[model samples]
Target: MSDYIVEFNNVTKEYVRQVALQNISLKLPRGKLIGLVGPNGSGKSTILKLIAGLVRPSRGSVRVNGRQANRMLASEISYLSELDVLYPFYTVAETIDFNAGLFRNFDMAKAREMMSFMQLDPGKKVKDLSKGNRGRLKIILSLARQVPLILMDEPLSGLDPLVRDSIIQSLISYLDLEQQTVIMTTHEVTEVEPILDTVVAIQNGQLRGMAEVEEIRMTHGQSLVEWMKHNLA
Candidate 1:
């Protein structure tokens, strides 16, 4: 009986005329780095939103740390989305301070350290920073939270190869597998393959596979990306 930090039980989400998710059920064990891979509009973001309590499921439930996903557990979970939603008027430091003040579990020191490592200018206003810097800032703020689970969606998108490498390195150094769980959704499967403990594949709003990374490689004799390409085809 492994302890689960996050659990989705037959969760479903629908938008007016379309079904975004269809009876999705999954359990995320504690302290594992899980990766979610799927094509666009496969309801990947919707699943993250449901877990973050940004949106409620149309049917079924999502639980975090043994409680219904809600604002009460905001301190226990940190979510970094694909979109950077910083206050345009605030400086990078100000944004971090705001998050720290809002979330009791936020670590200001960790945020500052991540900023320094990423070569981000804390004094620069959000509007003045480039897109890449904004993405890095979002990651720093999210990862710095002293939370049980961290959810990141498309963290590696919209960046050059060099910057992507730097982001990956920062994520690896910051992760503490003994205490924290990380769930990241990305199309850059190969980039994350080496670091992911488990991989969950989604297609057409349905779970295709969920298994340990090494077991997948052993059974398929191909990298996660290659396996995904064939299965997702």
Candidate 2:
């Protein structure tokens, strides 16, 4: 079995007028908190979509746990999209119940704990949620699933400072690094750099750099964001 949790081999993806990813290859090991960092339109989100089996690579292959990513792979991966895909009419409690009914791996205990950590109210309807609350709910739902891989596209986007802090803390609190790996995308690199084990930077749909967070700090004498600023300059 491959030791890597995620592997992309010579992958390229394109739309009609643009290429979102280009001849990219990456192998990420398990038991890590990886930060997918890049500017807008950098295809950071595309990587997560590929891993989640939501989009096909135009060329080559994407794999999770040595198996080709597909609909069945969804069973092993818990994906939290950048967009809020929950039913707006459903109360948070009902939404959690619905997901639990869908995935046997969904853990009600974990969901309730994370909800309390994020200060989410189970009785509140999704439609009444503020942007920050919606983001929190999305994360809570994903984290509740006991899966080997968790792919989050901009998990911190649209959140206020307080909620962001709470979410980060909850991630550290809830994740069992021995059993699972998390890959999250965000432009707010400075805020996330402290917890990241690795950082992958992409630009213009191509990989620019990737490395361990400490290697970056030791070699460049800067945080991931500062190194990105220097390199992206």
Who wins the TM-score comparison? 2
Model 2 weakest 10-residue run by lDDT: 224-233
Q: Model 1: clashing residue pairs?
A: none
Candidate 1 structure lDDT: 0.88
Question: Each model's TM-score?
Answer: 0.95, 0.97
How many residue pairs clash per model?
0, 0
Write one digit per residue (lDDT tens) for candidate 1, span 3-33: 9988999998998998999999999899999
**For residues 117-224, what per-residue lDDT tens digits would candidate 2 score against the true structure?**
888899999999999999889998899999999999899887888889888888899999999999999977888888999888888888888899999999878878
Give the runs in model 1 whose Cα sits over 4 Å from its true position. Answer: none
Candidate 2, superposed: residue stretches over 4 Å from native: none
